[model samples]
Target: MDALSKSDPMLVVYTKMDGRLEEIGRTEVILNSLEPLWITKAMINYQFEIVQPLVFRIYDVDTKYHNTPLKTLNLAQQDFLGEAFCNLSEIVTKFNHSLTLNLRNGSGHALQGTVTVHAEETASSRMAVDMQFHCLNLDNKDTFSKSDPFLRVSRLSESAVAIPICKTEVIKNNLNPVWRPITLTSQQYSSKDDPLLVECFDFDASGNHELIGSLQTTIAQLENLYNSKAGANFYSHKGQKKLKGQLFLDKFQEKVQHTFLDYISSGFELNFMVAVDFTASNGDPRVPQSLHYIDPSGRPNSYQQAILGVSEVLQFYDNDRRFPAWGFGAKIPRGSVSHCFNLNASTNDCEVVGVEGIMSAYSSTLYSVSLAGPTLFGPVISKAAEIASHSVQYGNNKYFVLLIITVCNIYPHVTSVQKFYPSIVVCRMELSPTSKKQKILL
Candidate 1:
């Protein structure tokens, strides 16, 4: 807990304003240049970036010119740039990946335009994205008193300011409550590239009929909804060329994920093998001070704890929903020495999978036997590799024992031949010499 507190992945976003404070007997409230939109969208991780260090609102519904509807709705927009990411990437990078904009023009009519990105020569301390904003700037900075500016900026609150992602839905009059899907409702319907068909029911001053337009959903519109309502609605497909949709595993944290799920098998089945190290130096368990001591409460010392942790997490990954846990080292804890003992063959590993098996083994071994050590780790690796090394007699999901070598010394003796086994690797955990308790992901 103490170790975690010191570095709990600092998850804070700080934004402060700095200027010539104030003169003589006066003070001015610092204003933000851009706006913050804390939007929670199930459809996308939507965000906006400014190039010229200008601040603007991040919009959900795209518009060409925003003047009326933009003024009414409460939007959360964040201001960065003057103090944020000024030197991280180039200004063009921000523009090249700009968010789509569907806003209304100063003429109170909707207009469409794109804010493209480009990069300029690096200056100052680092490189930045050079930008090209094509939208009408309106040259109305002095008119920015929040009273008449068509585009306005706001501040991001201290709270998460995270809006709950709205579920897929269909709205009306531009005021229709965003729709939420129910059972059997297909989200395959898209509003892309089509016009919204509104079933409007109203009468004009002369009793003439009128029908308002709204986006309708269907498979033909695979990615679009009612777009006919607003001719500019097609802008929803803005910068489609820029979007390469689909997820890739390359972006995932491999170590953490592999530690959790073993997708090594081509078919859907569970099977795994486990092996332990029995090198000399693991002091006798009968001794209370050893890392493998069976504490009064009956938990293995840290050496055993590592095995327990690995076993605990692996039980869930093993096919047949079971695993074979074995130990190596000196002779057996019993009469003759058996190189391997199926830790969970006699009893199931864990109900919830993984760690439970190791824990159960730890509990069962407490009253019996003791710990010994020789300190050699090569045999531990070879033992696990032996199953696949000599013959083709293992399961397809054949994961060899992860020889958790808890020795401060031994790496120097390791050679190339030992490094050839892909499935066999040593998780070296030195109980001493570490300046602080380390929790390396691997």
Candidate 2:
């Protein structure tokens, strides 16, 4: 498209779904280069049972739209270069998990360029390491007083790019500073044998940081330094000059963190539980603005959507689909405000048959019960803990998951959750209609 300068190329990825193309992601436009290597990665969930067809299209973005955000940019305004098509399974089955395909035009004629696709399985290990660092004798870079020191740890990629993993807080006016312990996960470092770049910088107020010293080492080497009670000497950016500053490891501990998949693969069952908020803050059930309002056109409300989204994925992992459902901040028949009550309106049994049974019970409770006072999470969490504790006592390998759906503020009862169940992993998801973003807290 460019006569004087090279073509500014960008790549768009799509997946064929039900006879239509759905865009998965797009790469950033590379300016003035015929061969462009993009750093942006498009993540896709690969299913082993089905064949997923992927399409890759290249475009030359105009110079006027170079400053536009990739998400908002219109692909119809750009010039089409070529495209390639392949199945996702083909790339994964390769020896090195990489495949190269020749590009073709709209008429299926061969083009000049070829695109290479590489598949890398994401690391599922949740293992992490914690270590505290301190400097012995550091080089001073400040003119008025001692230099404010901080440390930045980065992992070297296969292309030798330094990707920063974590950094320590800057201690003002200190030459030898002891930093607090920092944790590094296996996903960040990839492996203990992988090399890491540790750089000590003198923090400047004007944003121009001066590097005092740096060193290249691995996690295994740092562990050895902690065991031997030794310190490693720092050197300049180039290896020719060795500085007087020394880096010492104050503490090092490696934790074996197991992932969700690890537990499931080891014959552990996941027990699903749900709690819905029935407070007056949700507005009336008959109004369209209410979050708990059911539509006559069969459209689901926000609460129903949350239940379906989580239960559908987790139901396959559970051996029995019986889920314990409850409601909070509501008043039962001839009773005061109850923090927790069975969703099915059964006095003795709280467990529902399946996802359909849970949905039916929830709908029934909305009409039978009345919305009441302030929402409390302590009771629901305590009840879930009691079930989990009973299963553990009987030597049943089961993990309990409690999903709480509420629109009201939970700050009052958030602290008491740990007191009730310390070992339970709580994941809070906030979904908003005005905003397209979703926040997940783990």
Candidate 3:
């Protein structure tokens, strides 16, 4: 019945698991056309040992019943178009790597059209590709000595149609043309194992282009050639003549981003430390203009605001919520000036209970100590390194975070901390663009 009329076609594939056919994947519906080219691909895991029995079923969608076949769209109440059954192993064993099987109706009579299958393996992980290609010594299709070269990239889909995805800019009167790069995702572009066709053409102003040559290659193969610093040669006329054109991969980058569970499963834990700058450059705490100013209205200054903002997020990771708050360039209650003294004023206790405790200690330090001149970052950095070194000696698995708030000349001491510490984030605040300078240690 579907053969008698122009029908919307859909293909459903199934595999025999335990005596009954198990549905695998279905193609998209091609509307109002008897001969449809479905761009959707059906990917199956190829198993060598087991006899993977496959069934390809065609359907004519029922227009009245919302375009579903009669049994499923209805070809005027007869939805089934036709079906062909075969083992996947039989197709793979063919010499040509392609097979054309006869589609039979319910009464066992062969249909007008046949089902052709092409088998190819594909990579597992998805990739973001950056591709650029160039052609060399292309055959002149026009009267000129040189050929205007351009490339058309197409992806092979389940419908057996090569769908065009990208086209390069045409270069006139050039046998060798280096086209611009094209970016592709794994969904639109084939994976490392799947082959993509790149066809080189001689551009014509009349809109009639001539095909110079074509190359079929996988993303992984291009990457291999790039890694090897070699060029992949292209062929023409179904691999009979070796064309002069070669594809060179400009850049290839692959990344595997891990989830939060990945870190948790690996037994990783986070540890936090807070450092504060107590230099005279921050201004006198007694003055309202100072960064450490405590307003009468209880409005938090920049220093207090920064501590509260960072500690609030970091406290969740620390088991004890204990933070080591240290200050630099401050003269203690005693005559001596110190950079690594505890904000709590306790000689023995360096760890504070929580952010509230850190705040209480910081406020108490302001009243007790006097802001000293010439800020120094070395002592506090060395203090953190000492603690980190001790933890490593004890074989403790911990990530140390040292937060420093200072208006000091940190250049002389940065190299010392960076050479020994695992991670140190330097936050330069309240500075104009003209004053900023960057120096890399390594």
Query: Each candidate's TM vs. the true structure?
Result: 0.34, 0.59, 0.46
Ranking by lDDT: 2, 3, 1
| Selected candidate, larger TM-score, 1 vs 3 | 3
List model 3 lDDT by residue over 173-246, tens digit each.
Answer: 88878888877677666566776788888888899988888878777777887788777677776778887767
- Over 164-278, each residue of candidate 2 has an lDDT whose tens digit, in order, gives 9999999989988999999999989989999999999999889899999999999999999999999999998865689999999999999877654455556767788888888
- The reply for model 2, stretches above 4 Å from the true place, is 1-137, 142-148, 157-161, 168-186, 191-195, 203-209, 216-233, 237-242, 246-257, 266-269, 329-339, 370-382, 392-399, 424-442
Best by lDDT: 2
- Count clashing residue pairs in model 2: 0
Ten-residue stretch with the least lDDT total in model 2: 433-442
Flag the better candidate by lDDT, 2 or 3: 2
Ranking by TM-score: 2, 3, 1
Question: Per-residue lDDT of 334-401 in model 1, one digit per residue for the tens?
Answer: 44443344443343332223456655654454334333444555554555566545533544545444
